[model samples]
Target: MLLSACSSAERGPVIPFFGAYFPSWIACSLIGVFGAVIIRLLFIKAGIDAVMPLRVIVYLFLAIAIGLLSSILLFGR
Candidate 1:
Protein backbone atom coordinates (compact mmCIF):
# COMPACT_ATOMS: atom_id res chain seq x y z
CA MET A 1 0.00 0.00 0.00
CA LEU A 2 0.96 3.61 -0.32
CA LEU A 3 1.30 4.01 3.43
CA SER A 4 3.41 0.92 3.81
CA ALA A 5 5.79 2.25 1.23
CA CYS A 6 6.10 5.58 2.97
CA SER A 7 6.32 4.17 6.49
CA SER A 8 9.69 3.22 7.88
CA ALA A 9 10.20 -0.11 9.63
CA GLU A 10 13.40 0.83 11.44
CA ARG A 11 14.23 3.76 13.66
CA GLY A 12 13.50 7.14 12.12
CA PRO A 13 16.04 9.27 10.34
CA VAL A 14 19.04 10.60 12.22
CA ILE A 15 21.28 13.58 11.70
CA PRO A 16 25.04 13.10 11.84
CA PHE A 17 26.94 16.12 12.96
CA PHE A 18 30.64 16.30 13.90
CA GLY A 19 30.68 12.57 14.61
CA ALA A 20 27.56 12.77 16.73
CA TYR A 21 24.13 11.46 15.87
CA PHE A 22 20.88 13.14 16.71
CA PRO A 23 17.45 11.76 16.08
CA SER A 24 15.38 13.67 13.58
CA TRP A 25 12.46 13.70 16.00
CA ILE A 26 14.22 16.19 18.25
CA ALA A 27 14.63 18.67 15.43
CA CYS A 28 11.05 18.22 14.29
CA SER A 29 9.77 18.57 17.82
CA LEU A 30 11.64 21.83 18.21
CA ILE A 31 10.12 23.06 15.02
CA GLY A 32 6.77 22.00 16.44
CA VAL A 33 7.41 24.06 19.54
CA PHE A 34 8.11 27.06 17.34
CA GLY A 35 4.89 26.32 15.53
CA ALA A 36 3.03 26.24 18.82
CA VAL A 37 4.36 29.70 19.59
CA ILE A 38 3.03 31.01 16.30
CA ILE A 39 -0.31 29.35 16.92
CA ARG A 40 -0.51 30.90 20.36
CA LEU A 41 0.25 34.29 18.85
CA LEU A 42 -2.53 33.86 16.35
CA PHE A 43 -4.96 32.84 19.07
CA ILE A 44 -3.99 35.90 21.05
CA LYS A 45 -4.62 38.12 18.06
CA ALA A 46 -8.06 36.54 17.68
CA GLY A 47 -8.78 37.08 21.39
CA ILE A 48 -9.43 33.38 21.88
CA ASP A 49 -6.32 32.78 23.93
CA ALA A 50 -7.83 34.60 26.87
CA VAL A 51 -10.61 32.07 27.18
CA MET A 52 -8.37 29.08 27.77
CA PRO A 53 -8.15 28.14 31.42
CA LEU A 54 -5.03 26.05 30.75
CA ARG A 55 -2.93 27.77 28.15
CA VAL A 56 0.09 25.64 28.79
CA ILE A 57 -1.80 22.44 28.10
CA VAL A 58 -3.18 23.82 24.86
CA TYR A 59 0.22 24.98 23.72
CA LEU A 60 1.80 21.67 24.61
CA PHE A 61 -0.87 19.81 22.69
CA LEU A 62 -0.31 21.97 19.67
CA ALA A 63 3.41 21.41 19.88
CA ILE A 64 2.96 17.66 20.05
CA ALA A 65 0.59 17.68 17.13
CA ILE A 66 2.93 19.72 15.00
CA GLY A 67 5.85 17.51 15.95
CA LEU A 68 4.01 14.35 14.97
CA LEU A 69 2.97 15.87 11.67
CA SER A 70 6.50 16.93 10.92
CA SER A 71 7.87 13.52 11.81
CA ILE A 72 5.36 11.79 9.61
CA LEU A 73 6.10 14.10 6.71
CA LEU A 74 9.84 13.99 7.03
CA PHE A 75 10.58 10.43 8.07
CA GLY A 76 7.42 8.48 7.22
CA ARG A 77 4.91 6.67 9.39
Candidate 2:
Protein backbone atom coordinates (compact mmCIF):
# COMPACT_ATOMS: atom_id res chain seq x y z
CA MET A 1 0.00 0.00 0.00
CA LEU A 2 2.86 2.36 0.78
CA LEU A 3 4.34 1.83 -2.69
CA SER A 4 1.24 3.36 -4.27
CA ALA A 5 2.22 6.73 -2.89
CA CYS A 6 5.24 6.76 -5.19
CA SER A 7 3.01 7.11 -8.22
CA SER A 8 2.36 10.47 -9.76
CA ALA A 9 -1.00 12.05 -9.13
CA GLU A 10 -0.95 14.30 -12.17
CA ARG A 11 -2.95 13.21 -15.17
CA GLY A 12 -1.23 12.73 -18.49
CA PRO A 13 -1.72 15.16 -21.33
CA VAL A 14 -4.86 14.77 -23.43
CA ILE A 15 -6.41 16.31 -26.51
CA PRO A 16 -10.08 17.20 -26.91
CA PHE A 17 -11.58 16.47 -30.30
CA PHE A 18 -15.15 16.07 -31.46
CA GLY A 19 -16.33 16.38 -27.85
CA ALA A 20 -14.10 13.59 -26.61
CA TYR A 21 -10.85 13.54 -24.71
CA PHE A 22 -8.11 11.57 -26.41
CA PRO A 23 -4.84 10.63 -24.82
CA SER A 24 -2.02 12.63 -26.30
CA TRP A 25 0.19 9.59 -26.62
CA ILE A 26 -2.17 8.08 -29.16
CA ALA A 27 -1.87 11.12 -31.38
CA CYS A 28 1.88 11.12 -31.01
CA SER A 29 2.10 7.45 -31.87
CA LEU A 30 -0.03 7.94 -34.97
CA ILE A 31 2.19 10.78 -36.05
CA GLY A 32 5.20 8.59 -35.52
CA VAL A 33 3.73 5.82 -37.63
CA PHE A 34 2.99 8.19 -40.48
CA GLY A 35 6.43 9.73 -40.16
CA ALA A 36 8.01 6.30 -40.29
CA VAL A 37 6.08 5.47 -43.43
CA ILE A 38 7.25 8.65 -45.07
CA ILE A 39 10.80 8.04 -43.95
CA ARG A 40 10.68 4.52 -45.34
CA LEU A 41 9.54 5.85 -48.68
CA LEU A 42 12.33 8.38 -48.69
CA PHE A 43 14.85 5.74 -47.77
CA ILE A 44 13.65 3.49 -50.54
CA LYS A 45 13.91 6.27 -53.06
CA ALA A 46 17.44 7.05 -51.91
CA GLY A 47 18.50 3.38 -52.08
CA ILE A 48 19.16 3.29 -48.35
CA ASP A 49 16.49 0.79 -47.42
CA ALA A 50 18.28 -2.10 -49.14
CA VAL A 51 21.46 -1.55 -47.16
CA MET A 52 19.81 -1.83 -43.79
CA PRO A 53 20.16 -5.31 -42.25
CA LEU A 54 17.28 -5.00 -39.78
CA ARG A 55 14.70 -2.83 -41.43
CA VAL A 56 11.88 -3.84 -39.16
CA ILE A 57 13.76 -3.04 -35.97
CA VAL A 58 15.12 0.17 -37.42
CA TYR A 59 11.69 1.43 -38.36
CA LEU A 60 10.25 0.33 -35.06
CA PHE A 61 12.87 2.27 -33.16
CA LEU A 62 12.46 5.23 -35.45
CA ALA A 63 8.73 5.27 -34.81
CA ILE A 64 9.18 5.09 -31.07
CA ALA A 65 11.81 7.82 -31.12
CA ILE A 66 9.63 10.08 -33.21
CA GLY A 67 6.64 9.43 -31.02
CA LEU A 68 8.50 10.16 -27.81
CA LEU A 69 10.21 13.19 -29.23
CA SER A 70 6.97 14.62 -30.53
CA SER A 71 5.23 13.85 -27.29
CA ILE A 72 7.88 15.66 -25.29
CA LEU A 73 7.98 18.63 -27.59
CA LEU A 74 4.25 18.97 -28.07
CA PHE A 75 2.99 17.98 -24.64
CA GLY A 76 5.97 19.00 -22.52
CA ARG A 77 5.74 15.78 -20.58
TM-score of each: 0.75, 0.85
TM-score of structure candidate 2: 0.85
lDDT, candidate 1, 1-77, per-residue tens = 75785666755589887999998988899989999999999999999999988999989999999999998998885
Q: At residue 30, what lDDT does model 2 achieve?
A: 99
The TM-score between candidate 1 and the true structure equals 0.75
Evaluated with lDDT, which candidate comes out highest? 2
Model 1 poorest 10 in a row by lDDT:
2-11
lDDT of 2 by residue, 1-77 (tens): 87776677756788999999999999999999999999999999999999999999999999999999999999997
Q: Which candidate is the best by TM-score?
A: 2
Error of 2 at 22 (Å): 0.5
Clashing pairs in 2: none
